[model samples]
Target: MKTIHKIAFLMIMSTQLSFAQSSEDQKIMQLSKDKWQWMSDKNVETLAALFDEKSVFVHMGGSWGKQQEIDVIKNGGIWYKKATIHDVSVNIIDNTAIILTKMDLLAVVGGNEVTNPFIVTEVYIKKDGSWKLGSLSFTKTLSPSGK
Candidate 1:
């Protein structure tokens, strides 16, 4: 009887942990979506709050820091028009969260509109009980037509 009680207690704890993780993941996902919206609308103020001061952004064109990223977005250098998310997965380790999203992005860069599939990796660090984006990297993926 004691063994059965132990097993049940463990199961309950496991379920609770799952729920907690799920809630955390949902918050991160929503924040990611909000970031995309802000980028599309050129809302640099919100992006600045979300991004850490020393955050790194990697793109095919080049890599830059938070301020440069904000400038690029604000100046229409690399406008993120839309992101069609194909799949998104998140992994949390201690206070760090790694989010991988596979999506088709419609962007305007250098005054040219382009669509491409990419795997976007976002790293968030929990500081003072709040999450701040530390890094974002976009890797181009092969399209269905091999483009």
Candidate 2:
């Protein structure tokens, strides 16, 4: 009977820890939302604040660093319109978390407006008791025939 009780208690504690981690994940997701809003509005400073000093951006086409991301925004080359992101899920591993986000981004590129739906994976690493974005990878969801 004592062994059974010990096992049950451990199980309860493990569930509680998972709940705590989910709550923390909610906070991180909110930060991601805020960053997206800033990007849509071209609030470069606000967007920049969310990125870690060594953050890497693996965009749909290629890889870029912090400065490259910033430059795209500053030059008005990469802009989002009618931006919507949802169905976000977070997975935690010790001091690192992986956030998966679905995005519907509409923008004008070279005189033509385009909408690109994508799934983005963002890596958030805990540094100094705070979560900061370390890397991001995006996958295009458009059909092969450009549907």
Candidate 3:
């Protein structure tokens, strides 16, 4: 009887832990989706709030810090017109969350519009009770055969 009770209690606790982790994962995923929309809209005010002071952005051209990224967006250096997200996965470690997103990005860079497949990695850290983007890096990927 005691053995059975112990087993059941452990199972319940395990389930609760799983549920908590799932909830955190969902929250981070949604935040990532919203960020894409905000980038498309050029909503720098909201993005500035979400970006950590020391956040870094890595791009095909070069890497830069938070302010330069915001400036690039604001000045139409790279207009993130849309992102067709194919898949996304998020993992949390301690106070940091890392998200991997597979997608095709439609953007206007240097006044030329283009679409490219990319695997975007975003790192977020929980700070002062809120999650802030710590880093974002994009890696271009070869498209699958055909369209």
Candidate 4:
């Protein structure tokens, strides 16, 4: 019947859309992991290419622009020693993706090594078919102390 045909068409369309969204999620997730690696390695050049010119980074200590963030990493103001992700979830809306990751972060800030649990929000925007980091905000779940 006509009702059956319409139902089947809708189902197919829904599945196709889900697949597309899943693909985007995977791409963004991979990029996020790569970004963490770049941070750990202090690869400011790669991060500069990935970060939007007007991107913002928020930390417990302060918030800064893309260039300032790059400078901090390059100058060793804060060293991202390691990140152990506990969970990560991603949501994609049109050309933008929002990712929330809970992790245990080990870092050396101001010459002191510390560890803390944090929830990091990372925003990415698709531009010219490539994703660029728009913003990164880190919320500490617990106060950092010597690990």
Per-structure clash totals for the candidates: 0, 0, 0, 0
lDDT of 2 by residue, 1-147 (tens): 999999999999999998898799888888878777777788888767778889999876679888788878777777765567757888889899898888777875555688888788899889999887899887887732223
Which candidate gets the maximum lDDT versus the true structure?
Answer: 3
> What ranges in model 4 sit over 4 Å off?
143-147
Model 2's lDDT to the true fold? Answer: 0.80
| lDDT per model vs. reference | 0.92, 0.80, 0.95, 0.92
The deviation in Å at residue 24 for candidate 4 is 0.6
Ranking by lDDT: 3, 1, 4, 2
TM-score for candidate 3, residues paired by index? 0.96
Local error of candidate 2 at residue 118 (angstroms): 0.7
Worst 10 residues of 4 by lDDT: 138-147
Ten-residue stretch with the least lDDT total in model 3: 138-147
lDDT of 3 by residue, 1-147 (tens): 999999999999999999999999999999999999999999999999999999999999999999999999999999999999988989899999999998999999999999989999999999987899999999998861112
lDDT of 4 by residue, 9-102 (tens): 9999999998988888898999999999999999999999999998999999999999999999999999999998988999888899999998
**Deviating ranges (above 4 Å) for candidate 1:** 144-147
**Which pairs clash in model 2?**
none
